[model samples]
Target: MLVAGCSHFAGRRPLLGYSDKGVQHADTAIVACAEQLQYVCGITGVNQISTWEKFNGGKTPWVRVLPGRQVIRMTLSNSRQLNRQDVIIDNVQAGHVYRIDVGSSGTLLTATYTDLGKLDSYTIHMPRFPLEPKAITASF
Candidate 1:
């Protein structure tokens, strides 16, 4: 069970349309779900992505796509309602981030798509391996 859990964790990847070597940071657009407003159940052209994390610490559900007209199918839900919406994002600019907000207004579920501007900053974590020299002994 422990090994299975570790394997599952290691196999997870972001639901990105382009390959890591093919995508340039400056030319990629990001779409993220607003965790406070709604939960994203799935994304189009990809497997269902989990938007929640342990202790609510999971990074928001986001995908990186080429800058262009993109159709995103989302299953959004709130405390009172659940909705499946097909959101058309047109003319997405490179280096920009878009956020989807779904909420209830007067008993009506509304989804708002907002462009949050360019991605400000990002961090990458890598494991470091130690390099040690073996002890050498000389005989007389």
Candidate 2:
């Protein structure tokens, strides 16, 4: 199992009780990020993920993965910002591949599997903007 706590900044400086407000904001962000991560993992058929928050003069969010889990959690700090994060699993076994796409702001994720039920190379097509799509070939 894996568990991690989110970032927290406190006790640095207190200006008219603003530190408390800051802590609240940070806690909200951490919870939101954890929820997003769980949603993405769930889309990938991973159902043994959970997250919670701990407050002790600061805020920290933790994620827990159950036993025999093969999932990764992805957390985004700010949903208002537009960014791209991609991961390619190379040398994957010849079988059905899973893809999970999660985030706000209309982000898209694509995964392709080829050469199933045959002894041949598998080709994956992934779009990169309006230009030509990116091709990834894997042999087994």
What local distance difference test score does each model get?
0.53, 0.26
TM-score of 2: 0.24
| Cand. 2 Cα-lDDT | 0.26
Give the per-residue lDDT digits (tens) of candidate 1, residues 10-120: 213334745455666567777766545244333443223233333212332556667778776666665676666666788888877777777667666666679978765
Give the Å shift of residue 51 in candidate 2.
23
Residue-pair clashes, model 2: 0
Model 1: which ten-residue window has the lowest total lDDT?
131-140
lDDT of 1 at 87: 69
TM-score of each: 0.58, 0.24
lDDT of 2 by residue, 1-140 (tens): 11211112211111111123333321211001122332322111112332212221112122111222233333333424423332232332322222334445455432222212323333434333344544544332
